[model samples]
Target: MPDTPTPLIWLAGATGLVGRALLTELGHEQPVLALLRRPDPSLPAQQQQQQQTALVDYAQPASFAALPAPSQVFIALGSTIAQAGSQAAFRAVDFDAVLTVARAARQAGARRCAVVSALGADPRSSVFYNRVKGEAEAALVALGFERLVIARPSLLDGERASLGQPARRGEQWALRLMRPIAGLIPAAWRPIRPERVARAMRLALAQEWAAVQVLESAELQTVGD
Candidate 1:
């Protein structure tokens, strides 16, 4: 009898906070193919050797066509309206690009998927950001994956400077104000480390769940911890 082959995992947004942590978590245990907007020469030589990478233009559907099929896929792609420079640009990445990748992965034989979403995601949300996230979630459910894990994490805590990304002033200020009274805040609303979110995503995907499973920030803290 032959030994079973390790599963190949497809990861998008490999440079982002949660994505980076998830990559580290996957380590050398499973083969990984990281799809990125550009080359990241900064990746450690060992990790580079362990993980395959492909540069992709999320706006271009054809970019994902060449990707090899995988059993599982993870999407951490997202951007704030400010970073995107306009609401339309933000939607292009957060909604359109995300669904594009998901649709492509599903076409490539991926049965299980995990996606990072914001805390207040709701399709009917009056807030544009939340509305977009909600719409993405709804659309993913409609894709009919065998197993889907949606992580809704509150204000992600990570070192953006280390990733060569600009700091979000609002997040910085909120962290400062919340730190001293963190225990007083609701667990669901409190700041969560990107690593925790990453862990929760991995753990959730490992389970046998039917249809969709949503992991809230509070549950992420417990399960991820």
Candidate 2:
């Protein structure tokens, strides 16, 4: 919209920890077309220089047509089942909404898409969360992007509490305890930082790639480093 000649990047769900980190990682190298449900008035002036914010309506396919034709798309959109309040609600965001956006991305001529998923994803998984994530990945692969990168991270280390998403009472405490012992765990299952995940997403998009690639938590550490 700013009439910049730089290649475009369309980003969704940029309020998340990984998304926030990606914003910094993108820096002033390229312009990012940030898709937001509403404008963020708190955006820093420097960030405003590099990002062009667009108001998005999730249900309106027409809005997708107005977005810059991106060479790549990054989707960090996700939600907890508890926060969604029901499995159906969770699927709407994690699966249905994601699929919708992917379709739009494909139509927008984006050659590559990098999305955040979780470990242990399987379409046939009995676990609702894993099943939903898997379904999303499967759907995206079926969309036939020139390159599709799925980043599956384990427990993400971040200052979520600062955002009012305080650690819950159960496994969250265990994750905090395990964070120190991450080296003792399997690389694929180890906890990783949101920054690392963000870095991995950017790196994956920059490669001369075709077909699909899935990055486990362990692989993210090296790429991010």
Off by over 4 Å in 2: 1-4, 42-45, 164-171
Every candidate's lDDT: 0.90, 0.82
- Residue pairs with backbone atoms closer than 3 Å in model 2 (clashes): none
Q: Write the per-residue lDDT of candidate 1 for residues 20-94, one digit (tens) a residue.
A: 888887764588899998898766567887898998999898998988888899999989999899999999999
lDDT of 2 by residue, 1-225 (tens): 577577788888776777777777765558888787777665556888778888877677777887778878888888888878899988988987777778898888888899999988899999989999998999999999999999998878777655444355564786878888988988887778888899888988788876899998889878946
lDDT of 1 at 126: 100
Q: What is the lDDT of residue 161 in candidate 1?
A: 77
Q: Tell me, what's the RMSD of every candidate?
A: 1.5, 2.6
Report the number of clashing residue pairs per model: 0, 0
What TM value does model 1 have? 0.95
Candidate 2 at residue 34, lDDT? 78
- TM-score for every candidate vs. truth? 0.95, 0.90
